[model samples]
Target: MSASRRTEARLLSHDEQQLVRTTHHPAIYEHGLDALHELRRRLRALRDRERTLLHHKMREIRGKAEPRGGSFPGLADHPGRRRQLFAQALKRVNAEASRLARMTARAVIGDGARRALALRKTGEQWLRPAPSPSPAPAPDPRPRPNRRGKSHIPGRQVGSVSQANRRAQAARDARPAPPA
Candidate 1:
């Protein structure tokens, strides 16, 4: 065979194909790692934003012009403006905190999934066998006690003072007047 054809034939060997198959997933793993890193960075950014907003709110509450130990003057003493700013800052901080929490949760779940996949790829058996699902308990055969019955006055209707007052007033009005 010609030299180029020989090289091509070598490239198409079973071992070469197997090697490619074995190493093909590195790109996928690398992508997963990159995504995890990005998520961590975003979580940090959100946390920082939340901290800054909280500090601003604290300063507003204390009637300080600037944050503690800072040279800047505190905010103006307008209670309306302070209230508005405090509300706005609180909203922003809450939003950022929520976003960070969600991102962290997602990152944790994603990392767990990736680790499980890696473990599966390594062909190592779990230390313990998975627990077998237990059968559901049988339903009880005894009949349930009947709760709905006459003479069981519901609490709402039993002790209503307004109803009692109305009944008493009707009874009083219905009585015949004494002879003049």
Candidate 2:
């Protein structure tokens, strides 16, 4: 919140932003950021070694002749340009790092939202009563045996029962009938 993040949606608080930098992994992310770092470092090195480079180039070209601006006019701005390039590349890396941090903050927020929704659903479930188990409607008292005749309970195979169905049936059987 020092200024603002351009890459992400405006959401996180300052503390959350701090958390984003350290906690959520700033991924190498396809080597783009690392490459920018390399570029910036090389540019700074070039700027630092400017005198040596100029002396080498001048000695190779001319033994004793002094250089004037007309021969190498751009040389005057070469150090500035190198410095500028390094700063720009550093700025690019900083921007991308900020973007990754914002993304991580967004992910933490999303996960929290999901967890909060689950908690809300659980709260509602705990507040509400579970449906009572009930016996199936009256079946045929004189139904014939399975395989050769119809089942006592319609739509239910004579011997086919799942563990859940068995548990439900046991629960139903265990409950005494309510008084009229």
lDDT of each: 0.51, 0.52
The whole-model C-alpha lDDT of candidate 1 against the native structure comes to: 0.51
**C-alpha displacement of 173 in model 1, angstroms?**
50
lDDT of 1 by residue, 1-180 (tens): 112323323433354333223222242233243443443354345345445655675676788845535443333223233333333333433444465568879999999999988999998885688876987654776767998776866888887888899999999999999999
Clashing pairs in 2: none
> In model 2, where do residues sit more than 4 Å from their true spots?
1-29, 32-77, 124-180
Write the residue-wise lDDT of candidate 2 on 1-180 in tens digits: 122243211333344333233222243344454554564465456445554545555664686655543464443334343333334434555666577668879999999999879989777553467666776655666765677665468565545667669999999999999999
Best by TM-score: 2
* Candidate 1: residue 160 Cα off by (Å): 46
RMSD value for candidate 1: 22.0
* Residue 116 shift from truth in candidate 1, angstroms: 0.4
How much does candidate 1 score in TM-score? 0.30
